[model samples]
Target: MLNRVIEQFRLKVSSIDEVEDSHSSTVYKCNLSNGENVFLKIPFTKLKYQRELEAYEILKGSVPIPEMIDYWSGDEECPGAFLLSELKGNSLSTKAKPTIAFQVGVLQAKMHSIRPPAEKALSGIKNEFPNWSHFVEEQFYSFAEDVRDILDEHLYNKAIETFKRMKQELPSAVGPSFVHMDFRPANIIVDEEKVSGVIDFESVRFGSTEIDFTKLYRDFLSYDDSLYIAYQEGYNSIRPLIDLENVLPFYRFTDAFNSIGWCKRRGIENNALFLKENVVRLKKWLL
Candidate 1:
């Protein structure tokens, strides 16, 4: 079926090179037989093509997202999917540093500054980041089911317990600015070490600036604390840091819970490795 759709586009797929894979999609570098290169991202079952296409359309010129050239999606046969963009540059996050980190920080700040779209302008995409608390609350169900899959019993408990305590606290929230929900290093393509384009607006939501800001840590700095510090310095250079004390926990909850779900569906081996790593980072932040 996917092959049939590809044939409809008559795309000259050359060397189909694997680029990256996440919970929702897998990307390949499609060097076309016609000599042009296109990034082919096959959306997973969990992903909605309409959501991606809508988000990309709204963010087209507003952000440095890859412009959609064309897409194929419809009916149960296609299950509402698309393939339209690949930023032709290095993922800015492939190299982590004060420079790249700080630059990413500044670029994110610029993204946040774009004026909110008129409601009619974005009614097609679900713009409900204001309800992040509700979104986090839903994770509790997934969390309860995923405990046994977790390797480090101590850290696993820490994650569940922290999420519960944080939910109970329920602090007031902040800005619901235009956000690239998966605002991490892999989605950001770079040229000459400069951020060139933003990719994967699928997780796009209007939520706490903390959601976008903390990614500087998640994307590049989680494993690189020194770079995190540098990123902080760079981020601080551009704008005042929003008080993330309350929001980051929720952000971390969503991230960890999302991880568990991924493991549940995809084999737990690699997911366990990632869980061990990210759980440690989450614990460091909480501790």
Candidate 2:
């Protein structure tokens, strides 16, 4: 397959190494004969390929992200692949300093500020929901069904009640916006204490900006008040920060709930720790 990619793209490569952290895609770091470094990514599904490709088209100039150099929209024999310019950096660590958090916040705000493409221009992007709240509700119901057998009876009932409460009490979304549904430290790249780029946009979709903050908070902001404050400041510099005090708990709870369902789908054996953690969180929050 690599040889086929090389032949089809007419790429002159010096070296190629598989990137171990890629979960949803088979990724390779390739150093070209001309000394330019690039990444070759073959997404697991056509939907994922379309989402990432459309996300690049939307974010190219506005966000700090890798350049999409070349692509193959795959035929029956192979899945789609993208050759992307390497953004020189390391994945942002969970323990990164406040400065990087601030940059991440700014970049996130920039992403949210990008208006969705016109209705006719949506093409393959996943923007089917009428609104952000609708999207969240759909996510909860879908995942809830998936994990019905896995969750304890009492916990499942409590989760359904909590979802009802959230639906009734949560405020309307601030506005329609582009959300990076999987924003987290691992997807954020840092170079010399600054955010170099963000990657892994296969989960990108149209939703409220507030929905984007949950994972970042789970992984980074919850660890340090200073980082949270810095991130808020940076985001507010670009656009007004949402009132997290009221909305965060609901989003955070749903995030934990969805994670358990995700673990079930992906196999609890491989995600045992993650599954245990989220179950504990659900119990803590709901029971």
Candidate 3:
């Protein structure tokens, strides 16, 4: 495997180390003979690979991201992979100061404000619904039956009722925009104080910008109220802040709901419990 990759690049292989297996892909850190460290992303599924490739092509020059070295469409002998220049930085910590979160929030706002090129926008499965209400309603019911068994019956039933009631209560549609879908510190690379690059475009799509904030609020802002204030302040600086009173809870619930299923599938007991707790937290916010 190493020899094939090295020969393709006409470079000697110094080392190849597994980084981490994320939900979408298995990542590897490869050091070339010339002292360059590159990342190799082998997607777990073909659809994810296609989305990541298309996203990189479309998002080129529009945002900060790792430079694409090469993309390989694996045949029967090899699995598809992406070779990219490593972003020289570290992911921001959840404990980062409010100011840092504010900066990230600004970048996120800028991303959401971009009008994706029409030809390159639909990178994933077309999720067409008649209206935003229907979309929210579908997401509200996305909790699979098997996953529901993992939750306390009371909590699960309450969640259903709340969602059923709120489906008709969402704010008016603000129209489709470029959404990072998974924007968070983990996907953001920070070099010292400035953001050097953002990674992971498999989830990029056209959607409500409010949906993009779901993870940001759950992972970061929920820990510190000040971060929420700073993020809102930063975002409002670029675009007018939407009145998220009615819609925020919906997206928050969906994020928690989806995360719960993901953890359950991976057999992460503790993480599943944490996400279940978040479901409760979101339920409270729904009021």
Compare the candidates by TM-score and give the number of the best one: 2
- Candidate of highest lDDT: 2
Error in Å for residue 74 of model 2: 0.5
For residues 1-287, what per-residue lDDT tens digits would candidate 2 score against the true structure? 77887777789999999997676788999999999998999898888898898999889899989988899998886778999988878987767888887888899899888767785476557663466677788899899987787887888998999988976777767656888889988888898788998999888887777788898998888999989998998898899989987788898999999999998888889989989999898888887
Candidate 3 yields a Cα-based lDDT of: 0.71
Q: Please provide, for model 3 over 9-101, each residue's C-alpha lDDT reduced to its tens digit, 9 standing for 90 to 100.
A: 565668898875355677778887889899888776677777788778766786788998888877665567788999888886777777877
Give candidate 1's error at residue 43 in angstroms. Answer: 1.8
Clashes of each: 0, 0, 0
lDDT of 1 by residue, 152-264 (tens): 67766666677777777756655666667677776777777676777775566666566675555565677776666666666677666576566666776657656655566
What TM-score number comes out for model 1?
0.80
Candidate 3 stretches greater than 4 Å from native: 1-11, 76-79, 119-131, 268-287
lDDT of 2: 0.85
